[model samples]
Target: MSRSVSSHTSPVVRVDDLRVVFPTMDGDVHAVNGLSFEVPAGGALGIVGESGSGKSVTSLALMGLHRGSRARISGAIEVAGQNV
Candidate 1:
């Protein structure tokens, strides 16, 4: 996919290299692996993925909804033009 500059100002949410990892009994399971996307204000976005594709996890991360302290996250997550 091509990353194009939005015609407007900064997007409402800008996710770059967003990674979400969960710790399992076996080892650390990588949910979101270096996934990057941008959602401009008033723009609609859809994420298509099978089970365990990190679709829900990515949204949870963006909405600050994650369980346990064992979840390890890296990279950048910006919401409302502010990095979280």
Candidate 2:
């Protein structure tokens, strides 16, 4: 299946300096650090990396799945001009 999108449009999602850290018994696990990117209104982004590269962590952060007390997330995430 295929879909069409407008040519002139702003970014639908924007993430800047995103950092997600989890405190473990050993130490703090830096899942994602200083990650930044933007997805245009009709643009697509693919994140590929080796195991334990924080791909799932980044996705969780974007979806606000991490608990505030369990993980430390510092950065800016904007979707549709609204900060989330």
Give me the candidate number with maximum TM-score.
2
Q: What are the per-residue Cα lDDT tens digits for candidate 2 across 1-84?
A: 877777577689999999999999999999999999989876799999999999999998888889656999999999999998
Best by lDDT: 2
Per residue, candidate 1 scores C-alpha lDDT tens digits across 4-84 of 556777788889998888889998899999999887866768999898888988988887777456788888889887888
The deviation in Å at residue 3 for candidate 2 is: 10
Q: Supply every candidate's count of residue pairs whose N, Cα or C atoms clash at under 3 angstroms.
A: 0, 0
Off by over 4 Å in 1: 1-6
**Candidate 1 clashing pairs, residues 3+ apart or interchain:** none
Which segments of candidate 2 are over 4 A away from where they belong? 1-8
Q: What C-alpha lDDT does candidate 1 achieve relative to the native structure?
A: 0.84
